[model samples]
Target: MLRRSWHHVTRAASGIRWYVHELMGDTAYAKYVARHETLHPGVEPLTERAFWRQRTDEAERAPVARCC
Candidate 1:
């Protein structure tokens, strides 16, 4: 038996792995799904300073950090 057949887009990004569809840090999917985007444990595009700002604005994000 399945819990819920929820569908999500997934792929390996620059840093972490197994990111949720809404938290994907890629812009290619941003414009359309931006409204539904959410933050998850995965990569972020820090190639430029502005990229970080735009990403934060897009997702209202805060990185998931570990204590160790």
Candidate 2:
């Protein structure tokens, strides 16, 4: 019973961690790489630093209004 309870707790924690990472876009680069490989196997995917720099540049070019 104790072992099962611990397993449940760990699983739930993992799920929460995944959710948080996805929500915060922390997994964007990983997802991008997977899709890029599937869709364009021959092309090299952008480096993580370059990917984020491009993202930031695009965002700056078209600023979105947010109520914060």
Candidate 3:
């Protein structure tokens, strides 16, 4: 009984962690890597540093809705 309750708690905690990561954009690179792997099985995904640099460059080139 106690073990089952503990399992439920752990699963809920994991869900919360995933939610927070999604909310903060912390999982963007991970999602990109997964998609890249699926779409281009033989190619390598960009490194975190390179990913951020590319994203920044693209944003600068095509400035979208922003407040600042």
- Output the number of the TM-score-best candidate: 2
Best by lDDT: 2
* C-alpha root-mean-square deviation, candidate 1: 13.0
Which of 1 and 2 is the better model by lDDT?
Answer: 2
Q: Sort by TM-score, best first: what order? A: 2, 3, 1
**Which residue runs of candidate 1 sit more than 4 Å off their true CA positions?**
1-47, 61-68
lDDT of 1 at 28: 40
- TM agreement with the true structure for every prediction: 0.21, 0.79, 0.61
Residue-by-residue lDDT tens digits, candidate 1, 1-43 = 1433222222224223534433665544444244334442354
Q: Which tens-of-lDDT digit does each residue in 1-68 have in candidate 2?
A: 99999999999999999999999999999999999999999999999999999988988999688999
Candidate 1: give the clashing pairs.
none
Better of 2 and 3 by lDDT: 2
Error of 3 at 51 (Å): 0.7
